[model samples]
Target: MAETRTFDVVVLGGGSGGYATALRAAQLGLTVALVEEGKLGGTCLHRGCIPTKALLHAAEVADAARESETFGVRATFDGIDMAALAAYKDGVVAGLYKGLQGLVSARGITLVEGHGKLVSPDTVEVGGERYTGRNVVLATGSYSRTLPGIEIGGRVITSEQALELDYVPRSALVLGGGVIGVEFASVWRSFGADVQVVEALDHLVPAEDLAVSKALERAFRKRGIGFTLGDRFASVAETDSGVRMTLESGKTLDAEVLLVAVGRGPRTAGLGFEEQGVRLDRGFVVVDERLHTGVGNVYATGDIVPGLQLAHRGFAQGIYVAEQIAGLEPAPIDESGIPRVTYSDPEVASVGLTEQAARERFGDDAVETLDYNLAGNGRSKILATQGFVKLVRRKDGPVVGVHLVGARVGELVGEAQLIVNWEAHPEDVAALVHAHPTQNEALGEAHLALAGKPLHAHN
Candidate 1:
């Protein structure tokens, strides 16, 4: 016999978007049900962002141990206990999981642990139970995509296994040059593993402005990270001792472990979207500007929405959709307002239009830019991190974009996002008081230089 249930909102996939929506909706006095087969906190807390970053931080520690001499400090790292690392990762994950559960429970949100599939436009079937809601949010999230010829084995793996690796391999072949792949490469290389990255794109972090791409390549080269960019994967095969890969150029590379991190695909398979007539294209949920699926009362958000597979982006989408359903004043997501950060040794964070993008949109003469090197910045020198603060602007108004690469620069993106989205003029930012001796002060100085008021920098 089929069971039945009802709620004001049903959120499928208890990831960032789903849980956030359920909590917020319940906060608004709406009855909500959040369904998931696995533990909460989704991939970000489980195998993706959170765990991967934990491992990366471990790698950074390993690098710091090796470089303690530079700071006139003595330190030595004997070895990495896989058990200890995994336990540390698990602790971080468990703490967040507990917090999420508390949040959901305190709000009186019902959480059903089962694999949910849509039976109708507004209904989901899980554990033989039928749950219907006025608004259905499908935030199924995404999975890492592998090449057709490549099969992920114990030795050849994706980010999922890389997070839970039993032992760090002596050598690793990272098969993509995207954000995730490069990050892992940096981690592995820092951990004293031989790491090589291969990418089909012409430059690493290829989606960034070309100069940004070139700058990263230079920084990566300085760190001794080997790469084969502008090369396509021919095939992957398992050897008796290791894994081997051949590029389209007929060049071959071998390593004890192979990681495929090209990109991730929407988790839209066999979730009953087809029977419900939900639209999908290129493995992503098809949606209009409002994020509505073809089926009535069925909507999707986050990685499933198809642009910029970011957890925070999904956070915005979930809030917007819930507001739209509740007849509240809702604003469409400004996609460019979403900040992006690459967690590498030299981190990359950017928001809004790139210099070229601003130029193309507003014209060459309309766009002016100031490239401020971190060499002159006090904080960058103190942290031993090198990069630049790029300020993009129009002659008479708004700072268009800010791109950064350095240690902990991701934290500064909040200010950049505000400048870009609020349409704050360069002078407006420049005239504002920024705390002395901070990396963010560089942003203010860059703005001042762009606005024809030079302070702490020569233009």
Candidate 2:
């Protein structure tokens, strides 16, 4: 029999949410046990966010070199060095993982290196050892999902395999045109691969605002990225050379590799969650607004929860849960206020309700929208990026949504989130100053137009 342990909080799966909960709970002077089957920083640090973003950055650098003549630096456009790129991406992940390990150690949190399962609401069993705590947080994170009858191996792959590929394919077919799909497609295209995306939806990044999606589609088309929208994937077969895919509409396509980027599903199965009396909806842990499972002090956060599967969202929920356990009574998280970004070239970033959603909820008469073209912004012109900042607000009321599509637009989501979360009126945002000759100025310009004081744009 293994020895038993006790802590104030026992967090299962040391992914973003699990480690974050342990760190914050320990900061509040609570004894914490963070269990993991793998590395501490979890998928985000090792596989998902960090490594993927590093790839995107590399793609950006490739694009810069390929288009350097536009900037008049007289640089030669060379192909990507896969070995060096892998090394660079791995270096970034390794540095962050090391720092996270150091932080966990310094915080005096017990790092249990094993797969943990909830034997009871308050007890987690790992390696035949029981760790009991007053509170337990489930944050097992997520895994890449595949379609029915479509196995991921060899020529057919998911984002995980795509990230670690030794060589870019001559041509690739990406299934699903959502965030992950479009991002991978963008990276491959910039790396000089002939990339074609097939989305079941009508547009790329369909979850984003319609205008933003349309803009992204146009940009992708201009970049020579081929896509077949509104087409459902029927089947895929591995060929001697690559993959051959057939759509539900009886269309056939072939590529050197087929990337199945149909998004991710929460990793919760056979881990004793249901046996422990925690409720689950379609494999997602059911939690209240406070993230509590309503099953004996057990809570769920991150991808395990049914909301946004963003790493940052997971981090925020972990902190909230820790504070709640410490009697801080933190306010519940607002799902819509969370920022969303797709890190493809000509990235899309948004916060709050999308224009269509806002109108659907508040009625068309209650909603008004303004689109400020980035073409009018000096910085955008300099970057040679074409897109817009769109603002959606209640007629004569607060700004309800902010959507942006352009190069480096993801960085502007912080302010957009602040505006929507605070329910700031268009006039309120317009009253503030945005520095000239910056992509950020496009946001301010949109607000100014919405506030009925257009600058650098037509009213």
- Candidate lDDT values, in order: 0.87, 0.92
Predicted candidate 1 versus true structure: per-residue lDDT over 398-458, tens digit per residue: 8878898888888889999999999999888988999979999888888888888786653
| Poorest lDDT segment (10 consecutive residues) of candidate 1 | 450-459
Of the candidates shown, which would achieve the greatest TM-score relative to the real structure?
2
Task: List where candidate 2 sits over 4 angstroms from the true fold.
Answer: none
Candidate 2 has what TM-score? 0.99
TM for every model, in the order presented, reads: 0.97, 0.99
Residue-wise lDDT of candidate 2 within 1-459, one digit each (tens)?
Answer: 777888999999898898889999999999999999999988899878899999999999889988898999877767989999999999999899899999999999999998888999899999899999989999999999999989989999998899899998999999999999999999999999999999998999989999999999999999999999998989999888899999999999999999999989989998999998999899999988889998999999999999789999999999999999999999998999999999998999999999889989999899999888888889999999988888989999999999999999999999999999999999898899999878988888788888888866534
Give residue 44's error in model 2 in angstroms.
Answer: 0.9
Model 2's number of clashes is 0
Lowest-lDDT window of 10 residues in candidate 2?
A: 450-459
User: What C-alpha RMSD separates each model from the true structure?
Assistant: 1.4, 0.9
